[model samples]
Target: MRESFYRYLMTKRDPNGIDEISHFANAAFFDQAFPKHSDDYHEISHYLELNATYLPSMSVFDEAWQGYLEEVI
Candidate 1:
């Protein structure tokens, strides 16, 4: 699930543009945190809350999570 989410995030990155920096940064952080092996939203949210100091706001995560759900669910 983590791998899928990471790929989902990466897919948001613009190939010839710079509009998706947040997605790139979040993907990097997600890779580093190596978040739990669960797909539960709350569990991932808790993990991010605990370890995502680099994130400016949880809204970024929330956005990515929404997109991920749309893509995979």
Candidate 2:
């Protein structure tokens, strides 16, 4: 799953082409990647932490999370 997600991340792009990442876009990706886990925040957090290597970096993932939250809340 982590490998699949790593491949998936490579395909992600921000439509606006500003930050190279879009929280709204990634939120959609999350749902697609982990449909069952989407409702479970703890699972999501754990998954990200465990698969942190699949991501560019913890900081990048964090920026995405924060960006998502900012737009959401």
Off by over 4 Å in 1: 1-3, 13-31
Q: Which candidate leads the pack in lDDT?
A: 1
Count clashes in each candidate, considering only residues at least 3 apart in sequence or on different chains: 0, 0
* Cα displacement (Å) at residue 35, model 2: 5.3
TM-score of 1: 0.63
Model 2: lDDT of residue 49: 69
- Tens digits of lDDT, candidate 1, 1-73: 2455656666666545554445445455456664534567787778778876655678877887888888777
- What would the per-residue lDDT of candidate 2 be over residues 1-73, giving only the tens digit for each residue? 2223223343455665545345434544554454332433356557766754445555665565554454443
TM-score of 2: 0.43
- Report the CA-based lDDT of candidate 2 relative to the real structure: 0.47
| lDDT score, candidate 1 | 0.64
Per-model lDDT: 0.64, 0.47
The CA lDDT at 55 in model 1 is: 57
